[model samples]
Target: MIIKEYRIILPISMEEYPIAHSYTTTAVIRQDLALGDDIEISKSEPVTNIRLPDGKRTSGHFVHKVYHLRRQVPKWAKVLAPKELLVLHEKTWNAFPYSRTEFSNPEFLKEKLSLRLDSICAPDRGTSENIHCLTPAELAQREIIYLDIAGEQIPRKEYKAECDPKIYRSTRTGRGPLVGDWQHSVSPVMCCYKLMTMDFKWLGLQDKVEKYAYEAERKVFCQFYRQMFCWIDQWYGLTQADVRAMEEDTCRQSCSRANRPQGLFGSKSAVLLPARAARLVPESKSLSLPLDPSTGF
Candidate 1:
């Protein structure tokens, strides 16, 4: 069997409303199966979108969609099978929202404004036009927060960054330039990929070796979860225990934090607790053994 991994970075500007509390988006990962002269695509169910209340109407939208295809090899093809299969092609694409919005009546806004005025002084009227836009530099400062794949380190050139081409399109429309020859170039985004090899004999399905091979591949891909957890710990200089504790605390504190209005002063007591704990814990300080030379597909 042959396996290839790909990492893709989705452009954030593609989202119609990139709000702070909006659902987190991720780039899609795809795998294709190829054997000899045949190839098949794999499919998975799409993720359900989160529903939000909008006055009297309820709205929801999906963030990601996946598709798969498969083919069965003819019995005669087995006679000329290669000793090992080769993965010839792989690709990834960005996913983004086509549209998004949330609406409420003037009464709702007036009520909130009144409450604010009673507590303090009169507050500025906030409008939909007041939405915040993240500059490229600001976006870069934020962490990727998630990745699937493993390696000590992967070069940045292997991945492409998701960028907003809409800005360029808008500029072209306004200028109406009659260019002789103009070149357009975009920056690349960094991404990482990890690969794992696991023993399949433990599953006790040797009689159905072909089916077992497919199952094994799925398991190996899912093991990318473990790899991501390890990567996050190392990147943040946090111990495994500290990471777990931070996740637990983050969930518990989210509700309270959400209740507070955006940009209001707040204590960093919750945020600093994990950082201090992580610093106190020592690193594992161990080296991993090299892959076994006898291992093969």
Candidate 2:
């Protein structure tokens, strides 16, 4: 059966010295008709009803939810130890609702699968001293990188230019590209605008739209950033070795029980085997003991 939508209600407490409240988030996945029969409409889960203490004890209320997804992996998950896998799994599962769980269509599963494969094949960002820093203009000139659910790089840009100026501006400030505040630049607004123009033109972003594009871009990027953070927490928290060991242990236990060899042997097999051999030797001890006593007398 096709899953039209999936919802998960999570309860969290904001209580302590500061005060807190409870809330829930919802995520949606749908089939997109426009992108052919293959496109999937997916939305990330949103969080709500967060309570903070002021002087008022606010009762519970439902908050709005927004969906977000990012197609990139951070640089941290590659170095954690094997024991961290459980944490990774737990975090990833929890963060799934907040991530890009929807596909253009089920066919996008190939893309998704590619992402997973990329995570496996991509080299870990281990302790390399080669620090590459680029200005917004420089970064915009390079390729666009797409990441997967596991926060691994799945796609690389060839010679394709930027797709959207708004996206470029947002990327420079948001988590995807430049990250952090661009306001500190020589001419924050102008610098950002120029960077956006360059990157967007390169990526094919149209400049025809005006107004709150920057703000809109910011919001979109923030959503993406949140997803990336969730992924980072998920990935850094787990390792692959632990999963393998657990699976191996489970397989061994299953095989042993299915064969029932241990039960067939019984617990007394060691003692019984020796006793049976002694009996087969014929009890010469009795005759020997009696003969010795008679000779002594």
lDDT of each: 0.21, 0.18
| Candidate 1 per-residue C-alpha lDDT over 1-297 given as tens digits, one digit per residue, 9 for 90 to 100 | 212221222111111112200111100110111121221111111223422112122322211111111122334324443323121111111111111211111322222111000000011111121112324553344222122222213336632222112212223123211122211212111222212111223233323543543343333322332222222213233343543343334334432332422211112221111111111110110110000000011
Question: How does residue 98 of candidate 2 score in lDDT?
Answer: 14
Worst 10-residue lDDT window, candidate 2: 20-29
Evaluate residue 181 in candidate 1 and report its C-alpha lDDT on the 0 to 100 scale: 20
Stretches > 4 Å off in candidate 2? 1-195, 198-216, 230-232, 239-297
Q: For candidate 2, what is the total of clashing residue pairs?
A: 22
RMSD of 2: 30.2
